[model samples]
Target chain A: MNIYIGAENIISPLGSTAEENFGALSKNSSGIKKTEAAGFDKKSIFFSRFAENTNDFSFDALLKNCLKNVRSKISPDIFSSEKTLLILSTTKGDIKSENVNPIGKSVSELQNSFELKHAPIVVSNACASGVIAINTAANFIRAGVYETIIVAGCDVISDFVTYGFECLFAISDKPCAPFDKNRTGITLGEGCAAVVLSSHKTIFNVEPMRFIEGTSGNDANHISGPSRTGEGLYRTVKKTLELAGITEKDIDFISAHGTATVFNDDMESVAFDRLNMQHIPLNSLKGYYGHTLGAAGIIETAICLQSMRNNTLIKSMGFEEEGTVKKINIISENKKLSLETVLKTSSGFGGVNASLLLKKS
Target chain B: MNHLSSYCHISTKEIVTDKGALLFDNTEGLEVNDFLKTVYKKLAIDYPKFYKMDSLSKAAFLGVELLKKENAALAEYADDEIALLFANSNASEDTDKKFVNSYAEEHAPSPSLFVYTLPSILMGELAIRNKWYGESLFVILQKFDAAFFADYCNMILLRNAKACICGWIEITEGKTEAFIFLAEKNGNENNTPLTKQTIEKIYKTIMKQSRPSKV
Candidate 1:
């Protein structure tokens, strides 16, 4: 069974639609900006936030907006079809809510508003939630469990999450510079993005790319820190390539996680080098969107699809110099290339790492 | 179809096996930590890292330990063959509240508690303890849905994993309920096939027995 992914939608600080976000990226524009007195201690912190001046940037609103945007790009019947399933990926969904389960209300609301046939499943695997959710969609579609799956990843910026990262000193003082020597840590961001995966390609109003294969692996090492050897990442990428029946040589571009955290970037570099993909052109979208936590993977994959459609490789924003010990080719400037296949990888807390292959249809 | 090899249930009061046999009961008026510590001591597993995990992780760890004890065949499988699929209605709520209090009520935020705010951290703990680098997924559903679990387990087994350790572990408001089950491709003739009815039956039995009618 061929899983076709299309009708991508990204509602981020950059733009509302996928193409608009990609256009901003092509122009070297970043959504990250320093917000005065945003930190826990009233310190100025850098974060990519939706430009909407109102505090109405709630999780439920973002999810609805992203889904509405996605609905415009795909067949309307799929939303209410029994054979279609919805999967939501988020880390801390509406953390500020008084209810203990922050995601339940939003899931119910989305189901009711969209008239979904089935209750949505919410994946909350830290940052890997988005990638893993997409992979789960592919798995379900291949198994004939659902003919179509709508995977939406969303996370809103809240004091609970921001302060938590601030306490860990993981928040970068400036816009995140992934794969760069001066990169300090992640600049947290917020956004909602979604992609549709279906066995029937004709369902998409536009040409849908093939979702070749996706898999996840655990480092089995540390919960908070990445593996020094990139054990989990290497294994996941290796398994993904093996499942896809393709070699590293077949991957034209790599959308690396590159969270800009020193340890994370180093771990990714080691994994790529171990896979003998040191020279493959790779870029991290974190520099543009900041680390959007759960939304990072979906938004990045949507950008990857946009890049394939445009035949342009967007540069790794804020990446100016080599930082990792194992040298991997980092895209410093936007370049036009004949990109046929792209590998998207993400590594997050909990020793979790996920990788998936997307090919031009 | 996969086989439901073994399962274990952990509630606030007792730890029971899949067969509805009580393994351990909390008679010491112990809280979550003390209850977990008592179970850990009874099991005689000496892993210092267990003390550092949140309540959610501890419940999952204890449940897996009990499952492994019941089904020794699980130990025979190679690492990276067992996928961990877990879901809960209240995802890390206990830890999330603690983290929130750490910063809002308390003067400083605790990094240790903040790290466990995500429910998947429990999966990491299990992976680190067992050294299994297989696929892991942590989902938050409205309630325990047996059909979803059955369908997802079948899909996972078909894809990459040889077996799956699936659970619906919910810990919140000083109450805990964890039902962890092991699903394998083939099992002994006596083993039941992993189906929606079987999972729902087990969950209902445990929930009913653990929480008797108030009347």
Candidate 2:
């Protein structure tokens, strides 16, 4: 089934909404900037950030805002209590409260901010949650349970995320480089993205930007680290391609997860090479959008969908030199191409890997 | 066939099926942790490592033991044929809180405390223990959904997994509570059509009977 994702809103170091985010992507402007957080003793940390103006935003309010913006653009009557299922994904939902306790509370003790507002289904599978959420929603829609399903994902950077990454020495103090050999560590960012999928692709007059054919897999390796062989990612991409009923040759552009970290980039390269897709044009949005964590998957999906709609492609920011894994062609400059399909993949802390195939409609 | 091979719940030592009971009530309190010590002791696991494990891992530890005790007919098959699926609320908020709290006080976090942050780690630990290298997933939905469970099980079966170990495991405070069932491929040609109602019916009944009545 072809799933349509329309009208996305993002709060990243790039920009808050699609307009700002797109503008930043076109200009090759990065949202990563130096900030003095409370806990870190370091003078500065480079973060691809979304403004933390969430004081006025409740879980319900955020959902409503996303709904409101999307609703205004699309037909509101299409989703009026029409048995729409919501599958929301996030790495840190209301982690600000957890930062107060060092030992952590039990599952029942944790406050579920998203549950308090909307009755949508939630996912927190580390970084892989975003793509899984979309894939799950797509499956639900494809199964004919709900006529339409709402896929929303978000995560905010806080002391917990910062300190957690810092403990692992994964945070880079400067803007990230997607596939660059000199890349150091990832820069954390915050953002939210919402996509609506319907069973009938012709619901809205707008042509379907992309068709979601994605899959999720677990590596069963180290918990915090990605699999050294990229087995998880390799399998995920393979599964995604299998489900899409297409091989690697059908994909035009690759929206790489490209956290610009050492192990991650190398692992992605191995997976791409195994698929015999090293010649594909690829770049990481993290260099432009700042690793949005949970939101990165859906946000990048939206960006690719939009690029497909506009018939334009963007380049990887801060990508100076190619890394050791020299299989794929990294997009160095913005280029226009006949893009029919794009492959976007994300690997998270847990041995979780997810990949999605989106086609230009 | 797609029948109950063998399933167990270590907490309270009471294993109930649609047919009858295996053990009597042993402990009190709505908490899940009260009886986890027995699980640790029975498994002969180290206290410090056991204490440091997350609720899902502990629940998984107990679940795997139950699967082994029953040693269903399907256990003789390939280990990769068995799938593990978990569902829970609260997700990893507790671990996140602990992780954040570590840095919250001083901003410096110990790597040891940082390990259990992901909810799926429990699944990984359980895999390492059982060597069950089949399909696995950790889903966090609002409350619980039977359709989701049924759908996931069907997907596993579609992937041609020989058997499945699936359930809901939730723990808060020190309390751990779980209800898991082993499902095998059934019928001639090894096919069984299971619905959301089938899984939910057994889940609700086992879960209700496992807990002491309020009265």
Model-by-model DockQ, in order: 0.83, 0.39
Q: What is the lDDT of residue A296 in candidate 2?
A: 80
Off-target runs (Cα >4 Å) in candidate 1 are A52-56, A97-100, B213-215
Q: Over the stretch B104-208, how does candidate 2's per-residue lDDT look in tens digits? A: 675669676677776767766665565554556677755667777776666556543667777676665544556776766652343234667767676676666
Instruction: Return the number of clashes found in candidate 1.
Output: 0
Taking the candidates one at a time, how many backbone clashes does each contain? Answer: 0, 13
Candidate 2 lDDT for residue B156: 58
Q: What tens digits encode model 1's per-residue C-alpha lDDT throughout A1-361?
A: 7889999999888888998999899998999888899888999999999765775467888898889989988887889999999999999888782554668888999999999999999998888889999999999999898999999998888888898899889999888999999999999999989999999999999999999999999999999999999999999999999998999999899999999999999999999999999999999999889888998899999999999999999999989988797999999899999999999999999999999999988
Residue-wise C-alpha lDDT for candidate 2, range A97-136, written one tens digit per residue: 4343221131222224222223566666678777877777
Q: Please provide, for model 1 over B107-151, each residue's C-alpha lDDT reduced to its tens digit, 9 standing for 90 to 100.
A: 698999999999999999999999999999999999899998999
lDDT to native, each model:
0.91, 0.68
Which candidate leads in TM-score? Answer: 1
Worst window of 10 by summed lDDT in candidate 1 chain A: A94-103
